[model samples]
Target: MSTPLEANQVEAIQGYDAEKRYKYLVKEVVANREIWILTDEHGCVMLNTDYEDCVPVWPNKEFAESWATGEWEDCKAESISLNKWHSRWTHGLEDDELAVVIFPNQDEDGLVVYPDELDFELKQQARKQNQR
Candidate 1:
């Protein structure tokens, strides 16, 4: 397992722009071999964007927990193993026509991407990591 992120590291990552944050998500999720999301009693949280319904994902629990405020106060941070994400989530999300919001910050700003796109990138990153 990966070491837990320090407070400063979390703070710094939260301050990053959307692109940088998305990149961080790719790297951290690959290293940790899991993807973080918010879930309440009902099910996984979903955000409605201008164009599509997106499921917000984070690189770690700390980042996911940060979003559990206000309306989402009851939400809990949950992890989906990278293997499960690739094997199940990718196909399920695509079938449901849902996108993914990668590492949203306080302002709820993030990069919306297709499930297949993210799955491909994560797979590529995992391959590169394995090679090193």
Candidate 2:
């Protein structure tokens, strides 16, 4: 059973979700207030926001699992890309938790947002090779 406080916290996290995706919560995932730049075992790169539920590359389920299992770190990829629809966000998840927030790319299509820069650049290099 959820205490009043807990219920309020979940409610706060589900703020104004007309689409019901990304929301803020009193329950925070990231133990640190700072952004952590992290690289997964596969070496993919991405910009991670605060410690909350981190957003990792989907389809790459292994990498996502790593972050959830405490095998990764948080780093804010603050490049600031905008979108036409504010409802849709490119959120990375941590464990089974919903994304507390997301990177600024805000695009649900394509590469979405890299959780770290170094890995992203490296993966891009691989993508280029595979394409050719």
Candidate 3:
């Protein structure tokens, strides 16, 4: 079951293309100061793609929870603060050569971005938010 707000959000972004979703993710994560990912007893979930392995991220828990079905049914939404993401996650993902899938939709479509590229965008978003 989803909250009314969550349902509204789902509806609102239903028509957003991948690029728009990616931009929404950057803005939301910066404003929220956290990023959401799915995790289970083992570890954070990773997606295997033809080109590279990707860590799927969302702007909020509700979005992350939307992906926690099927093979990821046991997964739980986890939050990583923006500071931790910058201090640790970006470097760790870069070392592992993992890309990031930003805010995938129900059809499993999202923008696949390199760790450095995403990190840069997140920082830029954060800076813009600070200037406001």
Q: Which residue ranges in model 3 land beyond 4 Å of their true spot?
A: 1-4
Write the residue-wise lDDT of candidate 3 on 20-84 in tens digits.
99998898888888898999998999987799999999887888888899888999999999899
Best by lDDT: 1
Residues 67-105 of candidate 2 have per-residue lDDT tens digits of: 343333442222111121111232322223433223122
| Residue 26 of model 1, lDDT score | 96
lDDT of 2 at 72: 39
Backbone clashes under 3 angstroms, per model = 0, 15, 0
* lDDT of model 1, residue 115: 99
User: Positional deviation of 116 in candidate 2, in angstroms?
Assistant: 23
Best by TM-score: 1
Which sections of candidate 1 miss by over 4 Å? none
Residue pairs of candidate 3 with colliding backbone atoms: none
**lDDT digits (tens) for residues 6-115 of candidate 1:** 99999888889999999899999999999999999989999998899999999999999999999999999999999999999999999999999999989748999999
Model 3 vs. true fold: TM: 0.93
